[model samples]
Target: MLNVSNVSRVFGKKAAVDRISFTVDKPGFVGIIGRSGAGKSTFLRMMNRLTDATSGQIFVDGTDILALKGAAKRAWQGQCAMIFQQFNLVPRMDVASNVMHGVLNRRSTLATMFNLWSEADITRALSILDRLGIAEQAPKRAEALSGGQQQRVAIARALMQDPKIILADEPIASLDPMNAQIVMDALHRIHTEDGRMVIANLHTLDTARRYCDRVIGMRDGRIVFDGTPDLLTTSAARDIYGADASFSEAATSTSIDTLPRDQNYATTLLGA
Candidate 1:
């Protein structure tokens, strides 16, 4: 459902992504894992044209995303929703209103100018909040909710778009252990039951193993490993993360099994 071919992003002399290529089949959960500055986030941003590639191509449902602009670009972006690590909700707005913002592409300037959302649109937004287990918070101000509730509101907003693909950039990064698991489970359920393509940038190797169908590893702006999570053994992690002599052996020894099943897992395993 998504194909990225030889994509590269250069900032002056530095290449954040260098000729990276990968594909995510329909309804697949693909995880991009790497240490900070390994270009995982850059790669995910390029997939939705949030950050354009300096070279090569990205295709969604067989259409070249780089070739689109203006209305075409906006339309394409609406089909692929993004969830940020911070949740990105408007503090003063209620949850229902925040979710309804996802359909701005479908609303006219006049309708939006008056802050008018149709009954059906509001109903759909409420339904999505319910699906994400945040329906009770719909009438509450976004800032009034907990971190986990805010993330669920973000997910509900994404679902309101009815997107074909979801790009989650460290979606669970800021939550507590239980909240992180809740968000991860919600994302997994979306990929499995809703049959939507999910591409997540994850810091925890264990979360990638448990939730992703395939894991892609990057180092120095290049893809070093692209396969099932089981293929990401001790040696593969060393190849992705090891640099200094002292850290090399220790990095490999700290595999997914040794990591905790909490939000601290990312910090402990990836040292992020």
Candidate 2:
């Protein structure tokens, strides 16, 4: 389980993340929603310990995350995989090589720097690539693939880490609608089939409603709404995004209803 207790991050007069507290005990897909500068990304970064929290504590499965140091901290970071928005892959390296780097956090300095990956690691990388539906791309350069494919490769890299939790920061903000659905589907599959907890910082309400079992809305660095997608009503959305709720809903609907199975639900909740 993951426990966040009144965590906050302050920068001068601005609090990027306020005294927020939440917990995740089940394996499922979670979406963090908010407008830009709403601290969604900051919150995820804090959870991953990519940056430090200003105050309060974060614990994962009885371990004091904020208090951990050195090799222990590195190990924790490796286990909590992060998939970045920019598809952080080596442009020149082949896909398998890039995926192998995911294990570097747990590998020795000499072996990592020398790139002496064991056969087991190579096998693991191939399996992850195949599972993500990109086995053929393993031999290609990461830069050679399209944005959606690159993102899949990034997901593969995360899976290679064998993480219990996957944190995706704006994973699909740059993609077009079709690609966005594919990426979201892959994330959902990871949560359901592999039982890895998936948490994403999402930009659109419709996408969040479609893929996340739970939705969290943040504004000015604080959570304004927290509930299941079924309970995220129109009033709740307006409260979350204020006057821009309708506009956001319009954009989100035009973008996420590729198949329209939830068109009615989304339209009703979107208050369109």
Candidate 3:
């Protein structure tokens, strides 16, 4: 279980995340939606311990992870893997090696520097890439793959960590509609099939509604709504996006319905 109690992050006098409390006692897909500067990224960063929280505690299975230091903190980070909008793989490295890098914290620096990965780790990385439908690309340089394929490589890297929870910060913000659907499907599959908890920072309401079991709406450093996706009505969206009375839902819609009617394109978006 993950419990965040009154967590806040202050940059000088401004709070990026302010006194927000939340709990996730079950394994499911959660989508955090808000405007560009709505603290969604900061909240996830705090959860991953990438940034220090100015106040309150974050507990995982009863231990206050926020208070952990050194090795203990590193252990916590290992269990909570993070993915980014910009597929943060080493572009110059081969895809398989980049996936193997997931276990760097568990190995000696000398071993990693010398590219001395164990056969078992190599097999595991290959298996993860295959599971994501990208094993054939493993021997290729990461920079050679398309953006969507690169993102899958990033996901494969995260899976190699064997993390209990995956935090994806804008996982598909840079992809086309078909690729976005493909990436979202992978995340949904991870939560449903592997039973690992997934918390994604999403931009489009349509994406969240389609993939997430629960939706959290944030605005100005605070959560304004938390409920099942079905409950995220237009009124709630207006509040989340800070739209006035005349605001059209189109402001936050990214539904593939707007895509071109090309046969191949439609088939791709439909996961054909």
Candidate 4:
């Protein structure tokens, strides 16, 4: 359903996303795993046109997204929703209102200005929150919620858009182990029940292996490996993080069920 062909992003002399190409088909989950600054986030941004590619093209449903502009570009972006590592919610707004913000592109300016979201739209937003197990927090201020609740709110907001594809950049990065599992479970349910295409940028090899059907590894802005998790051996991890004994050791220690999915925990422990 989504195709990226030879996409590259250069910042002056540095190439952030080098000649990468990948395709996501049907409702399956695909994970892009790599070390920090490995270009996973850049690749995700390019998919939604949040960042422009220096060369090559991206196609969604056979339309060239790279060439899209004006209404077309807005339409394409709306069709592919993004969830950042940071719970990008307006702190003062209610959770329901935050979710409703996802529908801004579909609503009239006057309607949005008046905050006059239709009852059905409101119901759908609440329903999505419920699906993510955050419906009870809908009336609460966004800042009052816990980190996990905030992340779930962010997911609900993305679902409110009725997007065909979801680009999640470390969606479970800040939560605890249980919360991370809950969030991953929500994403899994979305993929299985709703049949939406999901591409997630993950830090741990284990999360990629456990949740994603396919894994794409990046290093130095280039794709180093693209295959199933069962094929990702210790040597492959070494290839991606060569001479970095610490990284190799951590990768070796990663177990599909035991790896810490919490990015904050990993950062605090590994000093990454």
Which structure among the candidates has the greatest TM-score?
A: 3
**TM-scores for every candidate against the unseen true structure:** 0.89, 0.92, 0.94, 0.90
TM-score pick, better of 1 and 4: 4
Determine the C-alpha RMSD for candidate 2 after optimal superposition of all C-alphas. Answer: 5.4
Candidate 1: pairs in clash: none
Worst 10 residues of 2 by lDDT: 263-272
Q: What is the per-residue lDDT of model 1 for residues 1-272, given as tens digits with 9 covering 90 to 100?
A: 77889999999999999999887766799998888898988887887778988999888778988889999999888998999999999999999999999998889999988889999998899888777767778899999988878988999999988999999999988877667777787788888889998999987777788889899989989999999989877777877776653464354232333434444523332221
Off by over 4 Å in 4: 243-246, 249-256, 259-272
Ranking by lDDT: 3, 2, 1, 4
State the lDDT of candidate 2 residue by residue for 115-206, as single tens digits: 89899999999988777667778889999988888888898888888898999999989887766776777788788889999999998888
Runs of candidate 1 exceeding 4 Å displacement? 243-272
Q: Which tens-of-lDDT digit does each residue in 118-209 have in candidate 3? A: 99999999998877778889899999988888898899889989999999999988988777777777777778889999999998887788
**Tens digits of per-residue lDDT for model 4 on 124-209?**
99988876767778899999987877888898999998999999999877777666666776787788789898999987777777
Query: Per-residue lDDT for 207 in model 2?
Result: 83
Q: What is the lDDT of residue 73 in candidate 3?
A: 92
**Model 4, position 167: C-alpha lDDT score:** 94
